[model samples]
Target: MREPVDARRTRILAVVHARGAVKVSALASELEVSMVTLRRDVEELARTGMLRRGHGVVRPMGDTGPTTVPAARGDEPVGEGAAVGLVVPERHSYLYETLHGARTALEEAGARITLHIAPQMAGAERPQVERALAAGVHGLLIAPRWRSAAGEEADYGWLAEVGVPTVMMERRPRPGSVLHAMDTVCSDHWYGIHLAVDHLISLGHRRLVLAARNDSPTARSIRAAFAEIAAARPEVEEWSVVLSSPNAGPGEPGTLEEAPDLTAHLRERGVTGAVLHGDEDALMLVQRLTENGIGVPRDCSVVAYDDVVAALASTSLTAVAPPRAEIGRAAAELLLYRLGRPTGTTGPVRRTELLPRLEVRGSTRALLRPAD
Candidate 1:
């Protein structure tokens, strides 16, 4: 006698109900079927609003409404029918402005957003997306941890498999990964770096230094772009690039002091111009150089990436302004589009990249001529 598939599914679900929760892998093992097959069943159940899938477990729908709560201390209302999850690395003071800007944009369109703490999605993210999934939000916006592109693919795949549409903010999937098939919203990193480097070079700075995190795809891209442009200039006598080590702990004082130390390492090599990957790092370098008695733009010039106020506050940081607020809005738009809740409309798979703009501020100056 052939057992009916629906009957088997009913029985499987009944067992799940009896247990209150069950892992998908375990269900597949029990049914002697592939995980893919089991996942399809779960998807059907999810589509029908019967259950919600998590990382390793499934929960019954059981009359619980979508997990939308009143505005908490750090959050504001995003409005109706549009529920999105924000998976950020960590909560910093600056994030509030970015999130608020996004909230304002989405609220105007009547979208509601719930912020979740998902630090794993940062540089070395954890497979901890289950809690956000159980909430059964309409969409997800991930600011995934910066790591190998392969890791990025795995994380996105995990989210997609759970039937929630996802968009990555600031990070893109590795090219050729199945997850890369999805859309992303990223800054025009290469062009931004080009402008930053060119601006410093034009200030009579013959030597240039590019500081970046080693092996970072975004950082690597920026470095390669700068290198290409620098290679074309003959007047620039020397240039040096180095990936800063995290080992330079916060406690390390005066590491940049003197011409024979870090600065000297660069000076000995005749490297004067400097471009930094992020404002945070740029400020760090500027402080180090100042501690070493080197004057910015005179002894060295520094440009920051991501024109956050923290970067601009420093007198020596001329920085490229990344559209952080705009990126957040774009990410929200992607999530809404996926949920069939576009701003004043809806659409199919959508993706976009915004160009970054260089803001010349007080930190840069033309090198002074030698005293006659």
Candidate 2:
């Protein structure tokens, strides 16, 4: 006969509490059992509201007392008496600006911010959230590192159950899920892409191409938006979208240098204009096109996202300018609202979506010739 489920659950909870956290497989091995048996035990304990399991490990039972989430940031150092935890995913300047804006806003409002960065999972956010809760932080402003909204609620719900208010920055809804409740701030990607497409179409670009990364939610949105816009333009008949690996190094089999294939694809489809997802890649794409004796804006027009340091660094790039400082300030303010320092009201559940402006530069010109 199988061991009683209640006894197994109690043993699992006890082990999780005593060990701080335990993997399901570890529990199985330690108890001289199979993985399936341990999983059933963990599931029963979870249903009873004893411990929380995510990814692979089981987190401790919730503290019934009121909880505070400390702001943790990777850009700043950890200190004693820091009541808020700010979790910055990685140390990029753009990300830093967002966090800095949040920090400045919070400080002006007399809130303490402890910034923590996790290079990967183990190095930062997971441990920081745990410690902040243990140290008495009542709320958390987590700039989640998820690429998509799917499966995010399970990770974040744990924070809510423990009585911590969380604000996700730069994230939008997944296909069948809604992660937006407290507040979410993201670039107006669909509208931005609309501007890009319209600019190309107006410039006589009947054959257009989009070069974008296929993995990110932002990239996926851009593609979907592109398709929506294209379907409306019957005059624009021949267009092709070439997906490229965003981080593939130069000269690799799948690298952006595959621009030759991209250009070939464009030529075959009679493409005369291109929309780039990132400015860095946009500049490179233009340079490659020019090297192939193609005159940008003269023979082909282009537009890209983010006219920041990358766009400015390029000699010429017609790009979308995300309101960087404003986005930073808005994220900070929303977080403060969650922290109870209401700046402006979008009612109780604060939500704001910011639009991006198109910056027309030297890269795009009116298309004079028809696709041949």
Candidate 3:
């Protein structure tokens, strides 16, 4: 009953070849389909070098083969200057550093990089990705948005249908689910949690709390790792405080108006150490605790997960720094490797996991107790 994907794509190419140049709307009307579906087919065809795309029209690739608009120029063959698309959620410091690393690697490989920013919403990335594919990118590096736990099983069937080699950046399918069969480069978040917990326990912290955003994927990983480690050490007391509200503003997740009184909560739970999932949250918590006359590193030791703001904070934070640049470089290398290989010749799915390093600063110290 449903039309086959290849069949639809074939029809699109036929139409494009016949007309030389066809507007997306006209094609949709001719095929009796919605513009979204038509555009998807066109994008796929363009990605495979079967067609080229302009503003809103599709054209058959010239006899010279697939046309690519390079981001930069260099003394290399046209194929060596192939363009690669990178789609990320936002242009934050961590992501920017990652992009820089990717750019460095791509340049070395004589490839050009094009960037697209996808909004942090469900299904919003599809359009941006389609646009990149239509622009004739040789490959793609993407950090897809997984908006909710219910949508964790989202698949990349569309990506495969497009026939472009893609490498996921710092993201992966949920555990126990079938792997997405794509290359991936991500930080070892579970090990980062271990480093934080081990450091706290070694510093005489028996009672610990993990402060995190409940809806964040990274937070979920940290929480799971904390639970596993806590279960193994029954003598230690561990708890988690989840921030249920959305981020207050750009780069500010813990400054919500409805933020709970962490001082009172920590006092009641007898938490002597805390591992916050974000630098913003940890910095805010430290300020709040200081305002309440609690001395940091004296009354409580804090470790932030993301190191973005660790050194910037008034009291430099002991934090886990993810290998941001390395992730980018690795992702670029994987994508370029895929591009160099023949279609379907990539023997095995590649997955690279870089470890996060813990940086000790003034915010945390060995907890000293009065004479027993």
Best by lDDT: 3
RMSD of each: 15.5, 19.2, 14.6
TM-score of 1: 0.66
Stretches off by above 4 angstroms in model 1 are 1-80, 91-98, 120-128, 148-150, 153-156, 215-217, 232-237, 245-261, 310-316, 341-348
Better of 1 and 3 by lDDT: 3
Model 2 lDDT at residue 163 = 55
- What does candidate 3's lDDT look like per residue over 115-175, in tens digits? 9987766666778888998998878988765544444454454655656778887786665
**CA error at residue 348 for candidate 1, angstroms:** 5.5
TM-score of 2: 0.66
Per residue, candidate 2 scores C-alpha lDDT tens digits across 1-372 of 787777767777777788766555456768776555776767677787777765445767763322222343533322212356677677444456667766765654345667777563322457767777787764566665544333244455454454555665555655334444556677788888888888888877888888875534566677788888877888678766666443522222332333335656666777888888666667777777778777776767778776655456445788877665666667766655554432232256655678878888888887774454
Off by over 4 Å in 3: 1-79, 155-160, 176-179, 244-259
Q: Rank the candidates by lDDT, best first.
A: 3, 2, 1
State every prediction's TM-score relative to the real structure. 0.66, 0.66, 0.73
Residue pairs that clash (backbone atoms under 3 angstroms), model 3: none
Q: Is candidate 1 or 3 superior in TM-score?
A: 3
Error of 2 at 97 (Å): 3.3
